[model samples]
Target chain A: MDALKAMWETVPPATPDDLARARRRLIEEMGGRRRLITVPRLLVAAAAAAAVVIPLINGLGTPAYAVTKNPDGTITVTVNELRDPAGLEAELRSVGIKADVSFLAPHTRCAGPRFAGVDPSYGTRPHTEAELKWGAEHWRSLQVIKAIPAGHRIGIHPEYIRPDETLVLEIRDDQNPKVLWTLGAWLAEAGTPVKPCTPVKD
Target chain B: MTSQVDADDATLIGRSLDDPEVFAALFDRHAPLLHRYAARRLGPSEAEDVVADTFLAAFQRRGDYDRGRPDARPWLYGIASNLIGKRRRAETALYRAYIRSGVHPAEIPGAQVEDRLDTLAVNRPLARALLALKPADRDVLLLVAWAELSYQEVAAALAIPPGTVASRLNRARIQIRHALEEGD
Candidate 1:
């Protein structure tokens, strides 16, 4: 048995050529360092561009938008306030589209207050408050619904809007749940009268 | 001043990142044992892939490394095991291929005639037994038997509790020994 063990231990090791090939293959797959640097460099350039463009666009606080799911299971529309900052969700509801409105934070160029209202059921449940608070603080609240029946627009707004916040609006179908849409803008409280946005077609 | 024997793996890895040549030294130190282990399960062709993938993944994920753990062998083995798991079909194919070919890649040439035959006899059954065991059990057993990793290292490599490692190793040994005794 000992002799058998000794023989078993006498296996030959792999060759250097194999190791070299593997190294080369791995380097290729990782796209080499040359490609990796490009992304960070591009980000730096974008930041520089933003620094220049931000001041000119100041006071145009980012717009808040809403996503609405129509009752007929037809479609969801993303309403952005920057371009059409009116009663967008109300219009959609008037057109028989059930809507969910979400207000995102604004950019420095376009600052606005932000607020979010989650269902009390989410926070009031035992052993769930901590989780709900954590989610609310760190991530956006996702409102789930059964189906957007006709004539009801779900209003989504931040708990309160703050300066330099971008308002993001997301809409989803109640049935499939995965059917969703999003619109984002910097909220600008320029006292611009909220105009009627053109009704979105299915 | 650092001996290959004494230098911890993390230190070696850190040095290797700065000086790629230092990596070769690590390869030289660990690859023999790892290759032998791979060769036992996978023939030479696939063993080469396992060794290469192990180091490459290690190099890429080095930033997330826990430097406090000085020995990198278990870590390397863990990565290699993951790579091997992905190629389970390939590994099984190689074993099936070996059984038909009557050749094990790492089996040394020019060994004593009787020893060679005994190795073949012992290993053939062992291979069959290994193939029959669950992947987890096989991993723990082979790391101990082939890689000579301690139960702690096996636990680290397999990411199982040490007690689990002991239990699996015991179970695998019994099965392997039984298979060998039965000549199955």
Candidate 2:
């Protein structure tokens, strides 16, 4: 014991020169990192970008998601792959629902306030774990877009929606099998138009 | 020209959210001993990468950091330990080589070779003892011995309960004792 503890006591603490490269890397990363992934902050900027580039999953032309009308008169959206956001939005519109959809790449999200929201539910930013838990608790009861208890499907209740109001769905690829993507769902005001999804660099 | 000399680690981390270069104060504060600890286990070369990855990961996850934890050692070392765990072969080889050559590649060999044979007789066996321990047991032992973290700190670092830290430390110490006794 004492010998084990004392075994390498003589190995000196690293000098500045020893850590210069690592320090440089850290400094470099700090400069290039544009966003801190606080849940609420990104949700606020959901439509902040003016660059209108809808993401298309390259190499495949087929639709990446399916919108099925459940037997109970609710809609089930199963997103098997993250591709063709515009096509998915058009699909929802054809089914008597006006929707704005953004499929975020990993470590990316659109800025918020793209349109005036009907309520504060559009902002799901939680800075800490405690806040995230609190947000999840309240967001669970959201009537417009309820994340179904299973799979990549969300149960959309058309009755809960109002006439002329758009369903704004910002789903990002979390890249986790269990949780899949982080979905931000809220309603744009009945008279207000929701802008295209803007990508916020994280 | 150093600022925030009086700031607590949590405060520094919080401020780094806005003025990110302020994070350099944190890297400056923790990196030296962290690098030394990594160098001891993984040799001087790989230690650099581990230290770099630890700080970068810490910076990214700074948003999720609990401002309540005043000292950042448990968080920083926890990240470093995870990085080191992935390079377990390098760590084991470091110990094995030290035992075989009676020289840790990172250590400056004693001034007189034959004159320090007595020290080698003791240190070499200790290195061999470290090699024979299980990786989890070794993690607990080194965090205690090399990093000098308290049981609570080790538990926080490894995300284990304090009782488990105590048991793992005891199991590791006994193994070290047995390996040394057998080496004799």
Candidate 3:
């Protein structure tokens, strides 16, 4: 057993170049969004809510995103473009829900257990397509963001979210207008702060 | 001020959320040992892919990482174990090849020729015994022996109960002893 421990005691650590290669791959995969993140940022803290509904003017002049509180206590977020997650989060907060939102570019996703999950929705990775369908995609644990078939919007069922839990959303750009976008939603465990979205290869 | 260096695994993972590149720091911190461990099971070439894939998977699942655990070794190793399990045949092949040739291609030969002969004699039998053990048992035994993870850490890494880790480990050790005795 002791000899087993010394079996390959000398295969030297991975060289800098090896690690550099992997790191370069990671950075390259994040290239498109990495650059998007560095553009002169908007000082959005104090004036956050306004940004949510009336963000950058798409060439056609629609607000980047709009949040509407429905009569049923749900929130409808009509996204004209995937931008201003900070503002969206603020808007959701103002609508009386704690939230974290990340607008991801194509080919990216926020790295996970970004927050402690309130339920099994974020507990384990589904092993099969069936598990995925029955477990995460259809469960109550998720619903912070659900596509509303008629248009480019999402429904936030605050009823599914608890007082201490946060509604976490990752909205990724699908590029094609017909598709609009795809989203991932989760509830961070009560009392555990959701980490800021870190876009990485999907 | 080596602040990043001073930060624990949980802190680095937390910070990486806002600054995604900070995750590369974690790869730098842990990849070496992870690479070596994989190499021991699957050879250098396969090990490279395994380590890369492990880190990539870990990155994707980083949000689910438990922050209460300051060190990510158990978590990372657990991920690596799953990846390696997928290549169980390759791991078994490595052991069989070492048993047949008394050579681990990845092992660096030491200066003592006489000592090398004696060590190989023992290692050859160990390799054979390792080859014969079930993949699950081998994972528990090797994690404790080569990775130096404690019983609790082994349980966490394999996502098994501590009692299961103990039973598997004891079962593996007994099997190794029986195989080695047969070899003698």
Highest DockQ: give the candidate number: 2
Model 3, B77: alpha-carbon shift in Å? Answer: 0.9
lDDT per residue (tens digit) for residues B20-41 in model 1: 3334445666876787777767
Best by lDDT: 2
lDDT string for model 2 (A1-202, tens) is 6787777777888998999999888877764432222222222235445423233244465557889887888898877677777889888987888898888888777765477655334432212323222332233215666665344577898887788888888787654433445676777779888878788865
Q: Candidate 2, residues B36-127: lDDT per residue as tens digits?
A: 99998999999999999999999999988889998999999999999999999999888888877777766766557674676787788788
Q: List where candidate 2 sits over 4 angstroms from the true fold.
A: A34-202, B1-3
Q: Which 10-residue window in model 2 chain A sums to the lowest lDDT?
A: A35-44
TM-score, second chain, candidate 2: 0.93
Expressed as tens digits, the lDDT of each residue in A14-132 for candidate 1 is 66565667645544433222110000122234445543211112245543434544454434433223334346646555544333333322211111112222221111112133332
User: Against the hidden true structure, what lDDT does model 3 obtain?
Assistant: 0.71
Runs of candidate 3 exceeding 4 Å displacement: A32-202, B1-3
- Candidate 3 interface RMSD after superposing interface residues: 11.7
Q: Model 2 - which docking category?
A: acceptable
Span of ten consecutive residues with least summed lDDT in model 3 chain A: A32-41
Q: After superposition, how far is residue B5 of candidate 1 from its true place, in Å?
A: 9.6
